[model samples]
Target: MRGADCASDHELVRAKIKISLKANYKSNKKHRKFNTNKLRDSSITNKYQQTLERHVGNLEQVGKSSIEGIWEIYKNAYMKAGKEILGCKEKADRPWITLDTKTKIKERRAIKTELIKTRNPIKRKEI
Candidate 1:
């Protein structure tokens, strides 16, 4: 395959890895233990478990690459979310600045102000 084709394949694999990581994260959060009820046979269970472990190890490597790719895609997502939640923007420019600081700050401030106004309403006394 050409270099471009190889790169595309790598990107596709990376995307799959990202999807798997997300699914595993959700599954781990939602369920304390993996559901192995389907594998009733001990041999099958052992095999399945081994496969899962190998897949998980591979996923970890992929996850690292995927995270790097994701950060490249939207390096400011965490920063933006933090700014929105914390009511403050980071002073330094993020490695990823697809959106300008001005825009991010403006949006974050607007959201923060809206949240505060909604959550902290003044009580009116009866006349």
Candidate 2:
């Protein structure tokens, strides 16, 4: 009787081990499918990114000449003002002027020129 009982307990343990192994295999298969789906989605997104980048490049090329013309106009204006106010002899290239500094200089010079012109008339009238 004791030996039969032992044999039944051994069979129960084997059955439980088999159940656990099947559960583990099912989980691994689900994980593999999820990873494959993520890889497919990432590849699709990369293709879209490449397509958008190509479109942007095409648009930039179409506008290139007009952008250059505008830059030249701004450059000439800056050089003219610099020569008038600061006694700068060299022509200013657009890339050479730091915009914020140039703007501050322009504002300061405008104020100074206006004040000088206004004060000069007052001094002449007094004389």
Candidate 3:
């Protein structure tokens, strides 16, 4: 190949590289769980039903063209009613294991490792 004269003596190397990258689409949306247990109360149930009905009453008047649009309206109404009436359930922060149990577990692990490393049977038994 003839090198271009206008530049330095080193020949220009041309190459094509195709790189394929995996798309990372992470959704940070957390689904809210409504407190359905509140519906067991008669007054709360009546309030929820009335709120839901009021939200959906005007749906026919809006006259949405597409099925998706109608569905979106219905979904929004239901979500709004539930959010107002039921609210989100609070998450409990209780620990699964007590701190005392955790410390004992660590001690057990340390003793097990010591037993594994000891060469003499007597030391292993002592461990």
Candidate 4:
């Protein structure tokens, strides 16, 4: 099947191919993502520092101040304090989209899709 339609005798040939993609299903649940942006907030940073201090104060009970021992205690205290102050957040597909905004966008997308598929100019400007 010579489907090539070359305007010139030396024209390059091109191939047309069709490909389909399957939708991926990845649940946003289970794993919790931390909000690093919260660190920029002075309130949160202060809270974390205060909490770290409190947690580390109890580290004396863990015993001797070996480098490894101190490091371990500090790390644990930092992580625990961070989690306690900031909490676990599940990052969203669109972080800016609120429930109401999402609904509106979905509705708008449906309208736009219908306008394109049906070639309805009125539907295009309905919003």
lDDT for 107 (candidate 4): 76
Model 3: residue 4 alpha-carbon error in angstroms: 62
Please provide TM-scores, in order, for all candidate models, with all chains considered together: 0.19, 0.19, 0.64, 0.41
lDDT value for model 2: 0.47
Writing each residue's lDDT as its tens digit, candidate 1 over 15-101 gives 334333444333444212333344576865666556544434444454667766645434344334333333332256657755686
* Model 2 Cα lDDT, one tens digit per residue, 1-127: 1212221223232233433344443444321111223324666456545544443444444466587765665555544433333342334467766899788877766654465467577764643
Summarize candidate 3's per-residue lDDT along 9-126 as a digit string, tens digits.
Answer: 3556787999999999999998899999999999999999999889887755658558787787789888999999999999989999999988887776666657657999988777
lDDT of each: 0.45, 0.47, 0.82, 0.73
Q: Which residue segments of model 3 deviate by more than 4 Å?
A: 1-23, 62-65, 110-119
Go through the candidates in order and give the C-alpha RMSD of each one to the true structure: 27.0, 39.6, 17.2, 12.3
Q: Decide which is better by TM-score, 1 or 4.
A: 4
lDDT tens per residue, model 4, 3-81: 2333223436577999898999998766555666788899999998899898999655667688898889888797788
How does candidate 1 score on lDDT?
Answer: 0.45
lDDT-sorted candidate list, best first: 3, 4, 2, 1
Model 1 superposed RMSD (Cα): 27.0
TM-score of 1: 0.19
